[model samples]
Target: MLKGLVIVCANGCFSSMTEANSKVKALLAGRKARQCCELLVLESALGKGGAPWDFQRGSDFSNVDPFAFIVLA
Candidate 1:
């Protein structure tokens, strides 16, 4: 099966690690992105809840399309 993978910027900078973390939180918080291909916040998501799901970063997440995964960080 093909799983969806997204790259979230959570380093605070645009497309950074901070942004990635935020996007993930937004999604989990029920804040859907209004923009198409909106940048994801990966850090915030990881902050809110420990990864009970099978989500991986820098390995399975890298090299994949950002929109492909539903990250909540």
Candidate 2:
């Protein structure tokens, strides 16, 4: 891993151990409430207002949702 490859954010990242731990707990506690919402967000089937997997069919995000892709170390 690289030194400057880590990023800290409100949703929780490697910036703080406490916040990062909390984020993990949330995920493990079946707090995946955003699963459906996230899938729909990436769906360009209806211009980002549809429902499905990510927009990898040569399309752009219709409604850009502030998303953060995190990796735990």
Q: Which segments of model 2 are wrong by more than 4 Å?
A: 1-12, 31-73
Overall lDDT per candidate, in order of appearance: 0.42, 0.38
Instruction: Kindly give the stretch of ten consecutive residues in candidate 2 with the minimal lDDT sum.
Output: 36-45
Which regions of candidate 1 are displaced past 4 Å?
Answer: 1-14, 30-73
lDDT of 1 by residue, 1-73 (tens): 3234345332233455555455465665543433334443343333233333345643575534333333433
Pairs with steric clashes in candidate 2: none
Report how far off residue 17 is in candidate 2 (Å). Answer: 0.6
lDDT for predicted candidate 2 compared with the true structure: 0.38
**Per-model TM values vs. the true structure:** 0.23, 0.22
